[model samples]
Target: MTRSISLIPSGFPFLDKKWGGIYRGGSYLVIGPRKSGRTLLALQFASECAKSSEVCLYFTNMRPKDLMIQAASLNFDIQSYMNHNLLVVVRIASPSEIYDVPNPDDYLAEYLHDIVAVVNQYKPNRIVFDELTPYIGFRNIDYLNDVFLKTLEEVEDKNINSFFIIGEPATQKAQLIVDTLRHSVTGSILLKKKAEQLAGQFYGGTVIISPNVGHTEGQFTADYIIEPYKGISVEPTIMKTFTRNDSESEERLPELSKIFKPITKIKHENIDDMQMNFSNIYSIEDFHLIINNQIALFKSTGQEFHLVSLKLDSSAILKGLITLNQLKNSVGKSVQKKDKICIVENTILVLIAKTNAHLLNEIIKKIRINLPSRDEVYVKAVTEFIKIYTLEISNSFNNSAELIELILSEEATNAHLTLSELT
Candidate 1:
């Protein structure tokens, strides 16, 4: 009888077929930008390998509990593997020490010793080392070169398939390490965030594979999406070119609608993804339409609606998003079920229905006090960073567009208004 294919599935059909499955003694490097689903893809691969193999080992600086939480966020059942003895997770002391020892003098020896110890103990068929950047911290580039080659040899000697997850290179040294590691490894998978005018972004990315690995040759790239619910789904077509080309090049290409297939967009329904603390917020256009409907309803029912406009800085959007995500639960508790919250670029909008203007005033005041400020140590607290504007939707407007225009005009006016003036 013929032996079955020994390739292990990555749970991504196109990826599996392209590579002919991950084989034993193969080493791979998975590289991507921050928050670009690098960890998700690595864990997804590990989860699939564990299901079919005797053991798969995962090494990370994250605590086992935190790791599990992260896996759960991606809808992965990592705990099941842990329970079944099919997966072994080891947490290093700190990210910097992944390839460093307690003493800088003995760093390389200790680093290799730690890796050898884990591999010997687990004897795992598959192994994953997540995030190789911190380990490269302040270390001699040549020493790191030796460590990479040695680690590959050690894993290959044991005939174990291994994956090393590395963040996108931020410095010249990092790029060197990445290039060296990619060349040494049996294969390399590159993940990058792509915001295509054609493809709506919910972590849509491109994957490129190196030559002479998993039946793939001469380099190949495919577009894929790592969705919250669906996990990773590679698009039907191989990406011949990047969607984010220069304006000159973009202008020369065929019309986007004609050249590109419509990628599946993420629809965030009201209160989508119960597992997350934050709800599925709307965009400015969607928020405007809803406000228009609310105005008509207010005219017919004679009910009042309140709109709270919170302004933020474009430079601090990422920081603001993180702060808002952390405080979403607190904000949700303060608002009613009928209230709607949406972020429009640098502004956060909270629309409350069937509430008295006076009560909303009080709520707004409380929000001013409770909301976090970008500055903390100054003599006078600077809540001036976030400008808030409260508006009562008027029913006298002829149409939703008119009402929306008025609201937008007022929003612009409020940008110049100070918190002191409001108080």
Candidate 2:
């Protein structure tokens, strides 16, 4: 007979929405490379589960001290859980100590047995195998598989949810082992470093629901970053577009209408005709054309142009657009006729002729000072919420598509996407 598994919130709206929370007695695989934020993701899951009064256990080969440090860095506060008796952390074996264990064959069996004993003693509601590969890597595949299967059976019998973190497999041998472990899990998520160049190292990957478990089976792509205090932040922009269906698409139309509704609802004489002038504004699509023209002009007359990106709150899109229009008016009054402005989605870009980063900053400062507080047009340089790119005509761009991707990637800035609270 099937039993109802208790569910725990995952703190991250994107994850909880996609995976339907961490279910008790469920096993999940989190696959990623070192520093790809997979560990942080697991810790976030474990912490949230513990917060809900579930007894959560963590088993890792990393030294307890080092694991604690890493957890602390990610704002996990694992120690607090220990204080409340909600968490039990087991340091299976340190990297250096694992190889030094005598009698490799017997050690594996006893080690697995010890972990099972601890689970029996505490009867945790959730469990995590942080870096499961190292524990079974040295043993014979057949022998280790048997032991692993036995361990899974014990956890399953207890109705305890589990998570296994596997390093990004590099070799055929490792891949084979990963496949073996994957077949046993209920669901899996993969995290990988994004190839796109940015100011800092950023990661993007996918979450796939196992066909054997969960309500969904398709793999959904997501972009995330590990923040100093905030931990993992998933981009809501991409997450909103991750899955599409007739029902979801139909629901989104009203939301879109709500944001743009003000454009027609609020009768402002100047704003009414703004839609007609959309053709005059250069779009992100026009990046290559504008850059090439600027380059030709620079080469002939020793002139320069720079691209400045301005973004507003994603959650406050309607308010932001109105603010953007106010900022646009401020910029229109200050900038020369030669300067070009564009609106792509919510962000605004200005192609300033005969300007450098320093001059652009000065102009931005004046715009901010001149902004009327009553208008609510808070416009600032692309330092955090957005990104700015300096374009040089001499710089080689293969095609317009490349330029578009670069500009759109500004959405992947370090700013975290906040979802409306899940009611």
Best by TM-score: 1
lDDT of 1 by residue, 1-423 (tens): 443436667655656776676666778888777655678777877777776756888877654544554565445566566768787776654433333335442453355446767788778888887765545443465666677788778887887888888777665555665676677887777776676522343566677655334444345567887664345667776555322222433211011111111111111111112234445366667777887788878878887787766665432223222233423433455576578877654556788888886777666555555433321211012244446676677756655566445545755655545443454
Residue-level lDDT of model 2, residues 1-423, one tens digit each, is: 878766656555566776666566877887777666667777777777788888888876655544544565445657667878888876654333444667564555656666678888778988877766555554466776777778888988888878888776666556666666676777666666555632254344443333236535334556666554355677656553333222432110000001100000111011111212333366655766876677667667877566655554553322222245554565565566677777776666667777776777676655455442221112221122333344433445544445445655844433323111100
lDDT of 1: 0.59
Q: Locate the minimum summed-lDDT window of 10 residues in model 2.
A: 253-262
Give the root-mean-square deviation of each candidate in angstroms: 16.0, 20.9
Name model 1 segments beyond 4 Å from true: 1-6, 63-66, 95-109, 195-201, 212-216, 241-423
Best by lDDT: 1
lDDT per model vs. reference = 0.59, 0.57
What is the TM-score of candidate 1?
A: 0.54
